[model samples]
Target: MIRIVILLVTLVIGSVANINAQSKYEQGMGKAFALWTENKPFEASNVFERIAEVESEEWLPHYYIAMINALNSFGVTDKEKLTLQLEKAKKHIEEAELISPNNPEIIIIKATINTAWIAYDGATYGMTLSMKNAELYKKAFELAPDNPRVVLSKAEWDMGSARYFGQSIEPYCKDIERSLELFATFKAESTMHPSWGKDRAKEVLKQCKG
Candidate 1:
């Protein structure tokens, strides 16, 4: 009887501990995202780094860290700064892939990091990474064709290329519209899972119409 009581008590304590850990993780992510929304990306990345230290097994934190670096690397004027940022992003991308291999989102972010470098100096990186960039998006789409971000990202890339060559972007605009439709009904695996790219898609669609 005493052993049974002890076991029940232990279970309750463990459950409570798990709840507390989840609560902390949720709170930390909330703060980090708030910081990001406020345009405090470096600070947000710092928060994610702290959360990642505790949630070492989770891939989302690493994904966010890589994403922060990857997005920030865009439109950067200094080549040296861009290189350092992308290198850090690649490190986190590797970490995330280790936890969640072949993740479509991770793969897309990897492509975005390359796009950042390409955007920064197409003359320098375009010839080298451009093919790799197309391959990444292709692989990501093959993995999750219905994924709104994947569709949207690929379409955006195609549109950019078309515009570069003075070709029509209207064809890829349909993909953007399809991505929006998918976003309307899209469901994330969890609250922590990514549910992004809809707004960006909407903006792009508006551009397509305009």
Candidate 2:
């Protein structure tokens, strides 16, 4: 009887410890996200890196780190700086991929990174990375067609391609509408999982004709 009581007490203590650990992780990630939302990319990235150090088994922190790098690379006038930044992002992405192979989120972010390079200098990267980016987007769709982020990303890329060639953007506008619909009812696997791209979709929708 005493042994059983001791065992029960140990289990309760372990459970409480787990709860406290999870609470700490949530707090850290929440602060990181707030910083990111506030335009403090460096601070947010630092916090995410720290969290990743502690949450070695979790892929979210690495994902956010890569995402920050990818987003920051945008509009960078210095090609060399952009290359270095994206290279770091690729390292974080590799870490995340190791933890969660073939993840839709990871795949989409890889495509985003490639897109950043293409946007920076299409003449240099388009021939090499364009095909890979398209493949990554296609694979992400196949893996998680219901994922709003994937839908938004793929549709947005198509819209950009259409506008580049003076083609109609009407077709991809419908896909963006579909992404918005998915976002409306989408449920993330956890609070830590991604739930972005809704606002991006809304902004893109502004370009669509009524």
lDDT of 1 by residue, 34-56 (tens): 67656677788889889888998
lDDT of every predicted structure (CA atoms): 0.79, 0.79
Residue-level lDDT of model 2, residues 34-132, one tens digit each, is: 676555766888998999999999998898888778877877879789888899899999999999999999998898788888878899898788889
Model 2: lowest-lDDT 10 consecutive positions = 12-21
lDDT of 1: 0.79
**Candidate 1: count of backbone clashes, pairs at least 3 residues apart or interchain:** 0
